[model samples]
Target: MGINAHFELGLGGFSLDAGFSAPGRGVTALFGRSGSGKSTLLRCIAGLERAPVGRLEVNGEVWQESGRGRFLPTHRRPIGYVFQEPGLFPHLSVQRNLEFGWKRIDRSRRRVAMDQAVELLGLGRLLGRAPGGLSGGERQRVAIARALLSSPELLLMDEPLAALDLASKAEILPYLERLHGELAIPVLYVSHAPDEVARLADHVVLLQEGRVIHQGGLNEALTRLDLPLARDPEAAAVVEVRVAEHDERYQLTYLDFPGGRFTISRRALTPGQRLRLRIHAQDVSVTLNRPGETSILNVFPARLREMAELNGSKLLLRLEVGDAILLARITRKSADHLGLRPGQPLFAQTKALALLN
Candidate 1:
């Protein structure tokens, strides 16, 4: 249930003397700033970068051990890798390119069939088209499908959406989510984007200077103000919510969390569906008392759990509402003027940027 590794490699002027263990299932993100050895670590795991004195075991299987002289080649290892680019063959049609992996992998050992891969990645339409004819998002989907078709035990994605535009990323994210949900393979996803990590990863491994600084549930790591990621102006908390009601008249979807109901901009979500919502700290405002007339539709009475000075005059407040934890960033003057303290009751107000189902 763990991927343990001890790497020792040199990359030009920088050397990677790092190691970390990722979970068996779910998306384990390799998160860090650029040039933090995230990709190098992944490449080592994939056997692309050989470690002079390294050991790697996935799900208790020893894939590599430098001391013992045991090392499995990249193709022999049950791994599917998706790089930043689609890496689709321009010469071949999408279907042919997908079949290339199937041909290389043992025919008897393949568990994921091509039909399922095509269906899962929505590659049915693009299969007949050439790579040049398909869009960036489409090419990425084809790449994922190709990897899945190989029936790999582990999936490694190295900033798969980094090369794409916002629209392309938006187009590909849901497919990635579906892949995570449907497939049984353990995924090691590399990314520097906090938003991407928040939306996708169930487990997070924060990398700093070629070492794992923090590793835990995504919600916990993301909400910690001590981490560098928390300094982001877009810093937020993720909440799991279930669909409560959908009002066609008002064009709003009501989602029920542990503490309150949130109305988000969604139309296709059905009742009983579940979704994770990102609520930014800056979007939240604290009020000493509930106001009578406010434009904010979502307001929950919360008790301040902790408060800490952020920048010179900014303060970060952690509040608990029932089982849900919320974050609010306020000015130190506002915190003092409102007499905010631990266990003080306050209202956390937010607009309809909520997650729906």
Candidate 2:
């Protein structure tokens, strides 16, 4: 069971007609630009706004069904909401604020224990501190810990890092990463930042003008040439890999994926540990023949799957390596010189630029 929702809302001149389904586990990102109804759709899921024509179901429970005259109020729904700012009580200490919502739940129903939440968010030392005295990142950490203590079935985060400075966002990203991996609750993270989405999301819902343009697994949606993300100059493909071995002498780590292996700078990853990596289109180079000697390490035999005109001067190539896909962006002159065509066998030299785990 997962989340299934449909909503139609009208406010002033704007209207939202959105419907989508998300897996019960892992982060499902709602991606769109400003005024695309990302926030409005999220609010609808939280029951903060009721649409005349709407329906919502979480896992097996029906939270809202306009046709059935059933609608669960905001407080009645088992959800945790985190907005841009940490809405902590200034009068209460950090521990007290966290305990406020936590105490409402029965002991028997507590899925996340207080100590676990404290440890997960690194809030143990800041228990006695007041919200006003904590730094921006610290305040947000406490806010997240507080949400965790509520034992929510679903978590909603609307750009929790948007208000934070670069340093603060950096400070909190590790803790959020831990939460993402450790928690079983599904998260609906709303953000326009591509980097954040790449780092945290397992699934994505592409939204534009109050509608879902596409929604699928992270790799599937990002690799599709027809999608806007693939057409963007900054487009990249995400691949799931696992640590296979470590070369201590060379200080390199070998990661195994569906069809090939990637060697990168040594990381402190354990054997069999899972990882996700981002490979940008521009970082990939196509060669008709495998180089006898090359400095670039992540080279593999690839089959041309598709090609599209990126612009007047450039073309985008989709190459299949093993079972996964990688994108390469090259100038029209380069494509013409190489005589690149679909179904042709070529070698792809890739440089992994970022790691997302």
Candidate 3:
């Protein structure tokens, strides 16, 4: 099951023509700059902005077909939308606000239970409080819980953390990860922040000037040098690894992926715990031979898969390390000195700058 959509909308000054299909489960991030039609495409899927020509199907169910003259109104669509703001009812208590949505659906149709939503968002203690009394993170968590209580078939979040401060965003990110882990419903997450997309997205759609520049798995999309994401200096490859061991004395943890092992500062995670790591291209360096006595703990053998000239002075190299792929950004002079070429064996050194749970 998956989401299939095609939309073409022409407004006064902007026009949007895009199509994409993503898996039915996990999150698919709509990524681009501010005016790139991320939100507009989302609205078209939700029926908020009627496209002159469109076709949409969710989990094999047709929601819209302009040729057939069939379009489901926003209210009829089984979706829960979370905007940038919480938008909780000021007059109601937190519990009541959450119940407002749960009560609307028939008991037989309810797929998400109240207790499940509460537990997933950690809203047990704040259930009795008012929306005004909650912090930005807490309020957003409640908004998410309320949305879940509605038993939506699809969850649409349009920059749910955009309005929150940095601290608040950090506070709520773990809960979002929990949601990603526990929910079976598909989520369409809209955001311009690359870090957020790398942290949460399973699939990615890169929109530029109302067109989809790329659409694929998060790792493949981010590491493609021809795409906008890879052009950014901070572009990275995301990998999933498991905690293999912990060194309490040194305060370090060893993470194992199919390629090799990564040693980072010890987290609260237990052995066998799964984690996500974002390794920036700039943090990786290529070497012809494994060097002895190096401070960098992560040095693995990789084969050069592709190399693209990013500019006159710099180049981007894509390397295959076992089952995983990594991108390294190095100067053209260095590539020339090393005689880098596709299918060449080399060692990649990663400093492990950023690792997320």
Q: Give the Cα-based TM-score of candidate 2 against the true structure.
A: 0.97
The TM-score of candidate 3 is 0.98
User: What TM-scores do the predictions have?
Assistant: 0.94, 0.97, 0.98
Instruction: Indicate the residue-level lDDT of 117 in model 3.
Output: 95
lDDT of 1 by residue, 1-357 (tens): 778888998878877888777788889998999988899999999999998979999999999999999999987889999998888889999989999989887879898998989888888778789999988999999998898888888899999999999999999998999987888788999999998998889888888878778888887788777876676787888888888998888887898998989877656877998888888889888998997887778999888988878888999988787788778889999998998889889988876364511
The global Cα lDDT (0 to 1) of model 1 is: 0.87
Question: Candidate 1, TM-score vs. the true structure?
Answer: 0.94
As for candidate 2, its clashing pairs are none
lDDT of each: 0.87, 0.91, 0.93
Residues 108-156 of candidate 2: C-alpha lDDT, one tens digit per residue: 8798999999999998899999999999999999988888788899999
Query: Candidate 2 overall Cα lDDT vs. reference?
Result: 0.91
lDDT of 2 at 307: 94
